[model samples]
Target: MYLLKRRVLQFFTMILLGMLLLVLLYSIDGLIPFLIVIAIAAPLIVGWQILFDQVQPQAKLAWLLAVLFIPFLGALAWVMFGRTPRRHRRVKRTSSEIRMFRQAIEMERIETANAVSDRFPLTRTLQKLGATGADGHTSTKLLVNGEAKFEAVLRDIEQATHHIHVQYYLFRTDDISSKIRDALIKKSNENVTVRFLYDGLGSQEIGEDFIEPLRESRVHVEAFDPVVHPLLVFNANFRNHQKLIVIDGKIAYTGGLNVGDEYLGKEEKLGFWRDTHLRVEGPLVRELQRLFIENWLYAGIEDDKETWDLFANEEHLPEYFIDEPKDSNGATQLLVTSPGKDVTIRDGLMQLMMEAKESIWITTPYLIPPPELLALLEVAGKSGIDVRIVVPGKGDEWFSFHATEYYFEQLLKRNVRIYKYNRHFIHAKTVLIDGKIALVGTANLDFRSMYLNHEMTIAQFETSSVQELHDAFLKDFDESILIDWSILRKKTNGKRFVEAFCHIFSPLL
Candidate 1:
């Protein structure tokens, strides 16, 4: 209903704007020639660009259709959303910083090369896509829900001796967010350096009341691609969806849970938030710290002195770089993906699916998988590998949920099992393969995560974390209702039509 209303409003607004454009053109003398030229040239130029663009076929087709049918508005929309802006300066600076850590990373790679290659075959491919390979001697604890993750994170923040780095897609003004803010303020008073970053669009509701306190305490804060800043205006499609926190360059956390009351199951509309987060210690923490600092730099922090201060000094680099404990057998790699960059997370997921021997189990809130990934899932299921997906029984977004439903028939035909979490919104994004390797991250199994937003995933191989995720999936299965094709066929024709309509917008969704 909400989506329908929004679309109707948009349609009427576009119609009014088009009418006004015509009125203005007619009021001017000899403007018909200019209008004719625009009508002829706009679609052709945009269509040519769409054809040659790097977007997926589905998205390209969607754009082409929009241009052909709704020429003026579609061309304007294309100019705003379709063009992928290059981050050349940000990438160059980030690459240089990453290079400074390579000497230490290369030394460790020499020691763990055999273990990484033998255990995780996808690590090398991920490395080529600009992600660091597996880091051995890392200890991991699977945080089962928002409660556990917050407890661990708060405790870590309190114990921070050096500095605390934090970022979230959504930072709400609620009990949990307040607690975190107060903790960080106390730490800042104790002389701990605190840097906080949040997505401007995702946390747009965070007003001055929530941020003024932090600013007063001297905690460095910035918004990633602020929605209404002079440098950027309403960048709705491209988002920084990374949820990360690193403490003292030793411990780090990342996963599906953002800093919000809804994430804590306090949002009554979506009860019992089922999510997954990972707490890690060892070399992986350094990688996470590197990512956070690089993102901090990209978030408009340009002062060379300020950036160098965050890394401490060259003499103390070994403490942040070479410190290893050999605490667990987990070999973990962090994979990041952004628009105009290789889809590291998607490619890594496909590789894992192809290598699956026994089962491929996935849980995500959104299920609009890319065409290639959808095909891979079908193939894996047809090959007799156990393929199961768990999605939300109650989604917060209307169009995305219906768009997910549209893919059910195709997957059902391939023998893949689908389960809707009946008890709560299952927001965890995970993939467990062969009961050995697992991926836990903020990236959903959808086109946006693959091609539009910035995303990160933790690929763990030969770890107890995989078994923990396997057990969690089993528990989730017990709480979910298995979906069947026969049941889907019983839906009303109106419902089916709505789903089909929603699916048409999946590329944009």
Candidate 2:
């Protein structure tokens, strides 16, 4: 109810603001300038809609129609209400930078070994998925929930010898966050190069004073993209949703864990938070370090040979996956998609799912997938491929939860196994297929993750990791409740209509 009311209020607010802007333009009293501005803005708005519509054509049709019908008013509504948060420039890598990084890594791959063989049947798949010759010798430990993740991070920080690179979507100033900050400061004081990169929008609530103490201790702290004025909040679209930490270019951490009380189970509203974090120790740490370097550079940190050399230790063999559209050396491909990019990770995942052979296992907190994605799963299930999905019975987003449930009904009818996790909000984003391939990253099975946000996923092929992930899925399945199709079909007509309406906006939601 609160969410519905909020949306209603926001709709009116946007309408009022659009009218004011239109009136202001008309009052300019210069027909030529007004016409010029409209001409320029028209194409810009239309092009934006076309691009987004192509990405999710089905769900975006209504919005596209509304914009076309109303023109000025429609464009304003779309801009003010239709657009999702823009991709933050703070985390975006320029085409040149990405190209350079890919070239440099490709050159590095020439010196690496062909770790893929018949014994590792998934090597070709990995190469296709983007793993290729990017191999690293590393140990990976999965951390379940915030407590375990925090403990592991603290251990790495305490053992840091030379440098520590940290990037996170959110870094709060609460107890756990402060403890980590203090540790970083102490490490910096001891001459350990400590670099902290945080998303400006995600950590905006934390004041400069929170980082002041770290700077005082000589710790290098940088916000990914800092908004200088309140009026520019619209520009806060792009964000660094990646959580990464590299210690002395040897150990690293990734996965969904962020630095906040809610993540740590210290928030009153979200208790016993369930999440996943990976502690990786291997040559792959260098690749993780490289990603941090790229993000640091994007955050305006100067990158030099000295900083690059910290990760130049070639003695350790690390399997690194480079995500490029044209690389063809390996079957394992790394798919990274952002709002600005032509190929999105979400779409890539959908494509992969369409090619599934035996089964598709997906786990995510949010299940508001686009219509096409929902249809793909429905088709896959109808075709007799084992299609299974696990979502939180109770989600952090209430509307999203209901929206997910709405899709589950259709899936259930098609024999897709829909599991509602009652333990806690399952925040992991992973998908395993036919016990041969798996996707692990921050990308959720939703429209926002697919199109609006910048997301990265490591597609592993023919690896034991897939089996492990499958086993984990089965374990989770045991703890979940399978939705009854008959019960769902019995829902009231009005309720079904409401869900159908919500599902229509799944792309925008």
Candidate 3:
């Protein structure tokens, strides 16, 4: 009934808009001439804008084609969603708070410089891409799927004494979400500071009933770029896709699992969800803490003096922030990317691919790769690196799944092996290289994650956690069916047409 009402409302809204447009057209005699002028000038202006920005060549071409073919709407969309607004760019790059935040971690960088550099040559380049250098004192544990991640999260939330910071791209009102919500409310009742941030577009379906409880319980909540208002709906191009949690400034969790029952294999469609998450302790938790606070501030949440002193500034920094450099088993680094910020994860992954001599194993739900990453994969495969990618046999998204299917032939032609996990839908975003390092986080192998969404990833070097992740990949590969020429030939012509059609719109997806 609610959906029907929404549809009826939307229909009436469109009818009203059409009537208004027709009235304007009839009333203004010079409107046609003005429109013609706009049609001619808009494409030229958009073309110039696209070229001036740091858009990829292929994306630039796509935008140009869009503006040329569908002038008015395309130009309006480009203005609204295509590029980051100037204001966002300024705040992201020039914010004094961010500058002070970076300076706060300078000591960590200097202390780990020699050891991290000697071990990982790409550390310097990654650091330049808005990530901290590898810290040796960190300890990591690999959480295989949503069950393990949620269990660990609930356990840690129960133990949190100081504060609980939780963020998710999607926070549904299912059983698991309620479980976590109830846990958070309990902690808030115990006088623990609870801050919750969620992506407005991703969690738009969540109603006031779900949120009122949190607020009533004194859980500080904010939605990142909320699309609840009609005028704000078009701003859905950019989303905060990171799933993170910080507990007591000591432990952190991040990866692909969000607060949904579908992630727990309760959904009937995408059955038996397969994913990966990580638990971090020691110094890396501090970096994750900084990221949470940065995003919290970005959501426009103001803090009182006591709260600000609890989470911010050098004077009130957590004791866990300045963890002594212990002779740990391995080092860990973080990769964060926002829409207007540096494309840190993409560049870091490409560099990691180039550095991979023995093997490059990837597992992701989406498979749409940017041209640069695709080229790197082709080159690595052709150069005899054991390149293998495992994607979902069943997908929850339509266009992106077909777009993923479109790239199968190109990858196989270059000797890159592909596998479809048939047991269930594999939503893990992971990359294992040379049996030594692993990347596990929220970014997918798609344009949405690499360019549009805010993403965070963790790079684990020679850790026992990496080895565990490596073994998990091996198990998944064993379960998955390999895709070869025979598989490509078996696809129907209609399926091929759908994939090709979807591939054309890959940039927007």
The lDDT per prediction is 0.81, 0.67, 0.81
* lDDT tens digits by residue: candidate 2, 106-200: 54441234554454444344445433243424445657678888998998899988788888877888999999999899999999988888876
lDDT of predicted model 2: 0.67
Residue 37 error, candidate 2, Å: 9.4
lDDT of 1 by residue, 252-306 (tens): 8999999878888999989899999999888777778777866776775455444
Clashes of each: 0, 32, 0
TM-score of 2: 0.79
Error of 1 at 365 (Å): 1.1
Candidate order by TM-score, decreasing, is: 1, 3, 2
lDDT of predicted model 1? 0.81
For lDDT, candidate 1 versus 2, the one ahead is 1
True-vs-predicted CA distance for residue 52, candidate 2, Å = 8.8
Worst window of 10 by summed lDDT in candidate 3: 1-10
- Candidate 3, pairs of clashing residues: none
Candidate 2 Cα deviation (angstroms), residue 407: 1.1
How many clashes (backbone atoms < 3 Å, residues ≥3 apart in a chain or on different chains) does model 2 have? 32
The all-Cα superposition gives candidate 1 an RMSD in Å to the true structure of 3.3
